[model samples]
Target: MTVNRRFTLAARPQGLPKDSDFLLTQDIVPPLQEGEFLIRNHYASIDPAIRGWLEPGGNYMPPVPIGDAVRASTIGVVELSRHPDFTAGQWVMGLNKVEDYSIGRGDGFTQPIDVDAVPSPTAYLSVAGAVGLTAWFGVEDVMQPAAGQTVLVSGAAGAVGSLVGQLAKRRGARVVGIAGGAEKCARLIDRYGFDQAIDYRGKDVEALSADIAAACPDGVHFVYENVGGACLDAALLNLAQGALVVICGLISEYNSAPQGARNIWQLLVKTATMRGYLISQYLDRFPEGVTAMAKLAGEGAIVYDEHVEDGIDNALPAMLRLFDGSNQGKMILKLI
Candidate 1:
């Protein structure tokens, strides 16, 4: 019998998730039934959103029961199939438990992957994946940032943040990124073509606020918020009238040891519409999101800077990089 190794949730995390919060075990892959197909996983995405799933309360879906494998999106190739819809050579992405092999019912799943369109499977986990879709939907359907407007993106060097900033840039808006280091800031401006990038590492909030004001002379008309808390306060200092603030994910508050984001009034005075969006809400518009992102990617209009960790064993370290502000772009695990 073939065995599939998976990462199971045991004890919920208190603040920053520890490796001990996960329990790794192997289970036998049962034989496929009438319409089932067996898949061998290729890559798994490790995102900041996964931290929310570890919490005891407040989740888009139900919490992962103790001893259950954590819920995640995985890309894999069909190794064997009894299903008529799926073939042995076709590639697919599905919501499956973290493991070496998964079974698909050939239902709402079985999203096809085009190997000719993209170079690597990593894209399926990044821009083609949920994070990429999040950037597209948030930028278009949610924020709708326009030309000549100024947009600020927090955690601008991260997976979703990098893509968000570039989308704003592609729309003819002045893009400013908030990153942690000079290197990341340089990559944001030089590599990603952001108009300017602010390094928040050891920098005062007022200084960052001033820097943002300097970069965005007209003021920030649109904000793609990722890192919340103090960064949120900084973005607040330079708000344009009727600004659209799209909240996709919050990496800052996920592992809060203490309180964060002292200022909340910026939204009120500037008449800014700060809204949080969950991807589940945009299920119907996913194809549109995919088309937009892929088209941009195909034309070299979107910048996808991936910070890759090659192996499932590096999942813990790679995921923690988000909270630590160390990752340069979308972090993905390359399972060999």
Candidate 2:
């Protein structure tokens, strides 16, 4: 019998997730049935979105039932197969359970990944995968800022935020980013090519909003928001007439009680629009986004960063990095 190690959601998180919220256990691998395949997962994606599924009331997805392996998006190699469509040693990417091995039925987020196409297979989890996908649709389909317009992206040093700014810049938008610390803020201006970067650390809503106002003196035409709370509020105060606010994720409120934006009245005053979006809603156009993003990255028009943790044991800490603003880019658990 083969033993599989898994991390199950042990408890609903109270605030930011803690190690106690998960349980590590082992199970004997059952024999494969018809149309089943087993995967030896190579990497696990640690995203802020995972926190929503842990809540008792859940967000977009249903609550991860307690005792099931915590849900994650993963990339791996199929090691064994009883399914006719899959073969051993093929690379795959999908929404997978956080475990050493997973069973798949060749459907629902499960698809073969081409390992030789990019610099490495891991890019599929970062720039070429969900991270890039989210940024592409948010900027191109929703925000759609024209040349010479001003664009602002909160959580700017992160995977999605970094790409959002670059894509907007490609369209000739004057880009400004909001990050947490001096280092990340510098990276936004120096590495990602933002016209300005605002460091939000230790700053209240008033101070942050003032910084945003100074950065985009012409008023912001598009706000690609990742962090909510104060970040969203600041962008609201600086909205230009006909501004568009694209809400991707609200990391600031994901783990805690929601703090509604206080400056929403600015929307009415400026005749602006605010819309929330989900990447999954644009599945039909993923190929279009992927091709454009990969081409830009290959041509040096887009850049990205990654922060990797060494083992499954470190998954809890890696996920916490999102809330604390410690992670420099996409957070991944390197299980291989």
Candidate 3:
């Protein structure tokens, strides 16, 4: 008999997540029925959005429901198949949660990738998969920045934030990035061609707002927000009359008790559209986003980064760091 290891949501957290919140265990796998296949997971994604899902209330993504293996994106290879669509040895990625193996019908996943096209199997979860696609679509669908307009991206040093800024630059937007430190800020501009980078660590919101205003003399035309809190407010204070505010994420607010939106009145004053988006709504456009992002990545127009930790034992601790600004880029667990 085959066995599977999984991470279950053991406890709901108050602020930031802790290792105790997760419970890891193994179970015997049952025989596959018709139209079913078994996958050996290669990697699992750790994202800020996962923090929002752990809440015990109404979030756009359904709550994990205590005692269930947490929901996540995983990349793996087919090990056993009773279905014709999924063949053994083929690599695949989709919503596989955090299990070492999954038994599911073929309809839930994309066709497996050619190992020759992408050098790493993990690239599927990073670039062509959910992370990169989210960044690509956020730039096109939400920002739509025009030539000479300024697009401000918070969490600008991160995987999604970095891509969003560069893509905006391709469209001729003056790109200003807000990252946590001097090192991250340098990487944003020096490495990724961001027009200007602001280090938000220990900076006052009013001062930060002034700097952003100075960097963008015409006021910001688009705020591709990823970090919420005072950084979000700073961006809010300097918006142009008709700017689009892409509410891609709110990493700062994830650990706060009873998460709330602040400085919302700025929306009405600037006549700005402040919209919250979830990737599930954009599933229909996944391929288009994937193609464009892959093209940019391949052409050197977009930069990609991943902070990989080895083994499932580190998954809980590694994910806890995201809320603390400890992660350098997209966080992934490399499972053997």
Candidate 4:
């Protein structure tokens, strides 16, 4: 018998999640039955959205059961299979628990990796994964800014925000990023090629808005919002005529009640549009998004980073990094 290690929810989180919220345990993997396959997980994605799943109430998906393995997007090799659709050696990406092994068809977000198209398997969990798809649909489909327009992204140094900014640049739009700290601001301008960067680390809404106004002198035509709260208000106050605001996520409020956006009146006055989207809603167009991202990556037009931890034992701490803003880019747990 093979040992299958996993992390289960120990207690519901009170506020921000703590290490004590999860319990690491082991079980034996049973032999695969007809049409079944076994996966040896190599890497797992730790996303901010997973926090909502840990809560008691209904969300975009049902809350994870009290003692079940915490959910994650994992990439692994098929170690054994009795299924006609898969072989023992293929690499696949799917929604799985943070564990050493998994069984059953990983239904959602599951697909075989094309190694020739994407040279790195880990890219499936980072730039070419859900992160890139979120940025793609949010920018190319929803926001749809024209050339010479200005796109401002909140949480610009992060996984989705960084890709949004870079993709906007490639589309001939001037890009500006709002990030916390001098270091992240510099990375936005230097690494991601944003035209300007505004540091929102410790500023009040008024000050942040002023900074945004100065950076976007002509006003912003597109707002890619990964962060809500004060940043959303500031971006709203700087909207150009008929601006489009794509709400990708609200990382700033996931752990607590959100501070209301006070400047939404600007949207009314400017005749602007503000809408939210979930990537799952565009499942039919995933192939288009992934293809575009891969092409851009091959041409060296897109750059990405992954902040990976070493083992499943560190899953809780690694996940906590998303909220704390310590994770540099995409947060991942490497289980192999």
The lDDT per prediction is: 0.80, 0.88, 0.81, 0.88
Q: Cα lDDT for residue 325, model 4? A: 92
Model 2: which ten-residue window has the lowest total lDDT?
Answer: 290-299
lDDT score, residue 122, model 2?
76
**Model 1 root-mean-square deviation:** 1.9
Q: How high a TM-score does candidate 1 get?
A: 0.93
**Residue lDDT tens for model 3, 1-336:** 877788888999878788788899788888999988888888989888888889997377789978888888888899999998889988877787788887757664455765455546676677667878887778787667888788999999887888888788888878999999889999998888998998888888888888888888888888888888878888988989977888888888788853445677888998988877767778778767766766666666667788898888888877887877778878898877
Compute the lDDT of residue 7 as modeled in candidate 2.
79
| Residue pair clashes in candidate 2 | none
**What is the model-wide C-alpha lDDT for candidate 3?**
0.81
Regarding lDDT, does 2 or 3 come out ahead?
2
lDDT of candidate 2 over 174-281, digit per residue (tens):
999999888998999899999999998899889998998888888999999999899999899999998999899999898778997999999999999999999889
Over the stretch 286-307, how does candidate 4's per-residue lDDT look in tens digits?
A: 7788788877876788899889
Q: Which stretches of candidate 4 lie over 4 Å from their true place?
A: none
- On a 0 to 100 scale, what is the lDDT of residue 262 in model 3? 65
- Per-residue lDDT of model 1, residues 202-291, tens digit only: 767788888888888888898788887778878887889888777777777788754445666877888888888977787777667766
| Candidates 3 and 4 compared by lDDT, better number | 4
Cα deviation at 258, candidate 3, in Å, is: 4.5
TM-score of each: 0.93, 0.96, 0.95, 0.96
Task: List candidate 2 segments past 4 Å from native.
Answer: none
